[model samples]
Target: MNYDTVRSVDPAVADALEAEVDRQGDTLAMIASENHVSEAVLEAQSSVLTNKYAEGYPGSRYYGGCEHADTVEQLAIDRAKELWGAEYVNVQPHSGSQANMAVYTAMLEPGDKILSLDLTHGGHLSHGHPKNFAGQVYEVENYEVDEESGRIDFDEVRAHAEEFDPDMIVSGFSAYPREVQWEEFQAIADDVDAYHLSDIAHITGLVAAGVHESPVGVADFVTGSTHKTIRAGRGGIVMADEEYGDAIDSAIIPGTQGGPLMHNIAGKAVGFQEALQPHFEEYAEQTLKNAQALADHLQDHGFSLVSGGTDNHLVLVDLRDSHPNVTGKEAEEALEDVGIVLNANTVPGETRSPFVASGIRAGTPALTTRGFDEDACETVGHCIAEVIDNPDDEDVKAEVAEIVTGLCEEFPLYDDDTEGLVFE
Candidate 1:
């Protein structure tokens, strides 16, 4: 974790970098979209491969001196294929949003219609928020989860699809707490004669480990970020059958991005290799178990949970019912003050501004990576309930902070003597 070379060259930036590492080591990361990658992944990302400008796929590049780039990129591609069982894979998109952009470029026109979940109802901005490029270029329609059940109503989605007649139907989600039935979305897309793009950005590792149902063979296109649950490099990937390989590759390179970040791809290769090991599945399963435990503890404590529980790594708490006066932002600040890091998020039927939403979303992937188990996650849930229940209590915040510090000490993340970050 030491940055001696960086310190020698630029002491100020080095200080910030070192401080960031220490911050991660000290706090509890409960953000559903964030994870702690292994030190091996860290080293690979900072390698000299960053100097290259590989503009195309492996063994078929648009530039010279790309042999090592080809090797690293191919290894990433191969491991991703093995992980997801896709016939084609593209590891070059800069982020999950860019991956979606490439999918749109490959399969859609500027004025095409896109039907996706509503952003406030657990969908992502890239799915077609009014301010995002996808919404500006595409005619977008949105579907909401059932109000009472907090789950998708397939009948309503079908009716919406019939009326909207979208050119593409996008599935998967960001703040969603339950497992997705990809085949149902595929059936709706089939009924509408539309293409299906399943964005599994948040559950890439769970899907790869077979803990969650995958959309790889079932959807028209599958895209994900490597940094989320997969904990690879900070980038996106697109997967499809070989029939759409050339179009996807060209769309990602010329239509969306310029050159590939070869160093990041090297990191992806190393992380993918790590994920292929047997213990990664144990980590993935533990992630789900931890989420369940957290969800149960929160619900038992009288908090309102979206979906009533979780089938994955996160639980979205709608504070409107349990704590009427407390906004998500207030709870977020109080929790951060106690060294527990999570995010305020929008829930279904949101009435407040997105910035001060009525809900909080928390996940267990990062804590699970730090070797947290079900009991630890339940304790974290208790800490959350405590702070949210008493957002203005300085005494409670101090007590919770002490407990968080003890947990961080108990489950240390990166050890200098160990071989990178390891999970038993």
Candidate 2:
């Protein structure tokens, strides 16, 4: 919170930091995989614990001077276990991708077949993208969504699993806007004798807050990012049944990574504590409500939303019909010009490349965190619709930008007593 210190060291860098904060204060952030962390979480992330090098699990470190570091690490692990009802947790993977990698290292051999959702549909890169380690090291097979429903086709998943006889099935996604069918995934994995790993990186908070059904109860392994919806610092966690605890811990510590980020683990502990609060349920419910409201507003204004609408915090907008002349990249740029932030995304069966996607992905997590409700969601939806409908209209963009500033004024984030606490 002390800008004076940073300014004395490097004035230019300080100016840039202030400018970015000003921009965030004026705009609407709708990226589904991003959220606003609480002051406590940020404090823990920037704490002195970052100076330590804890090489092993709590109370069993390979190095000395880790007594307090061990306590922080154990706190993170204990909180994660309570949050997800898992028997064991490894709070050391640097990211969700690394968490998945650790699982593969623990369980699978090279060239083992793995079944996962197709990347072009809703799956993430770690879920077996050809260029990723999972694909390079394992034989990968994919299942697609139902073209009509825009949801996973369980029958297709089962058929592929049976034929492929995969050693593992990775279930979870990045952009699909509906609830995961964990029961179907479990049944398919059972039929194929495959280990089930659910990467709930995007929905970890929803699961913790009881807004979404948790896959932890049924999955052999569950991986997640503590940030996304969980509102933690930037880190990843892996939770498993007791049967896989030793393998997972060894994989994380020796197979993939070295010393853990103790400060980030402290932040994760704070976030898990926040998730346990009674009001977190309300926050998660409102997050979904805001998304549904925004989706409906967009649809009413003639935008085509993937999966009809969202049951969670994100909505994938297919712009092919709404703005045939505008690519997702162009739409994103236009919206950015008007103080709204979102990401370009690929729609299923799209002819366009990922960089110039045919669709835009928007969400309500950050906005809802800042206290935006259904009414504000509707207004924001109209603003996006206007910008996308007229990407080249500078006057319209300016008007929408003014409206966005006004909305931010109404639901200010970190503007009161907590203004400087984010850096504390």
Candidate 3:
């Protein structure tokens, strides 16, 4: 996986690039919002189309020489429409966060009110957190999940919405492990006369494959990351009925961004085409099964999962109950040292700082991409528990590293010439 051309151009940059490929090939990527794209997608993302400045939609571009760009972007839009069955889709936003931004700009005024899930309880920062532009511009209120169940409490949400009478109710979560009720959220939005934006960023592929409930036609607006569970290029998409189509497209173009990355659009097109295959459904199912196996095994080791169990591709382990002294940061660092990579996350009733959260979040999307099954995921769970239980023990780390090595060997990655972007 040597970057020969990059090495000839810049040795230092090439070294870093090659090292990243090695890192991914060797490590267990358990980050729920991350996944591995095919070599075909990688090639498309690195194509010469990067040099082209396509400033608008197909056949309506603000620039010249957009023939290829039109082809790629339209292909992406068509494939996405087919995959999600959306009446309209815009594959422009650079990220999921940006997709949320586009929806907000299109639907609400500056002082409009928004009701969203609390950040510590599985919501995204863009939902209403003070740190984001959405929070800065709009008056925001938050709803809570059922503390006892670690799931959304619709009764509370309805009550909160009734009082707040928000202009929008944002659904979708970053670290939630249970299946959400999209229709119930839509009902709440209806009663309150608010727009519904379902940010299915983490479960894009699952929803597309029918493993998770579809928010496409249920919500007023649906947004997702093209990279996460979708395994597409690095970008965001907004889907809605034909009524919101023009507004979203305008908001994305002159409102938010200027030029689109045609290369990434090409990648999105290629990956979406790949996802339409029958095997992708099998992949989505295995992703859920592997997550369930991991959650069960971790619970068996006395680790407390946020909701007692998971119905999706991730598990939220609140370390407070199992390891009273270990923070999620400590657990994450320990696991990473043993070649297992995930993230520290906040739990429902979080007391610790967000930087050093009360919980660790792990998912199966990347490992499932690497061909890992339930038994292998259970082994991963055992290794994770052992390491978190003994972070400073050299023997434990060495043993876990050996196990990770064997797993990587069995499910090898990029066994082709796609190393450092040389795809063939």
Per-model root-mean-square deviation over C-alphas: 0.9, 1.8, 1.7
Model 2 TM: 0.97
**Arranged by lDDT, best first:** 1, 3, 2
Per-residue lDDT tens digits for candidate 3, residues 1-424, read 5689999999999999989988999999999999999888988999999999999899999889999899899999999999999999999899999999999999999999999999999999999899999999999999988888998989999999999999999999998999999999999999989999999999999999999999999999999999988899999999999999999999998999989888898989999998999899999999999999999999999999988999999999999888989999999999999899999999998999999998999999999998899999999999999999998999999999999999988887876543422112
lDDT of each residue in 331-385, candidate 1, tens digit only = 9999999999999999999999999999999999999999999999889999999
Global Cα lDDT for candidate 1: 0.94
lDDT of 1 at 229: 94
Superior candidate under TM-score, 2 versus 3:
3
Ranking by TM-score: 1, 3, 2
* Best model number under TM-score: 1
- Per-residue CA lDDT of candidate 2, range 111-174, in tens? 9988998887889999889999999999998988886788898888888888899999999999
lDDT of each: 0.94, 0.89, 0.93
Candidate 2, residue 79: the lDDT equals: 88
Deviation of model 3 at 213, angstroms: 0.6
Estimate candidate 2's alpha-carbon lDDT, on a 0 to 1 scale. Answer: 0.89
Candidate 1: lDDT of 251?
Answer: 96
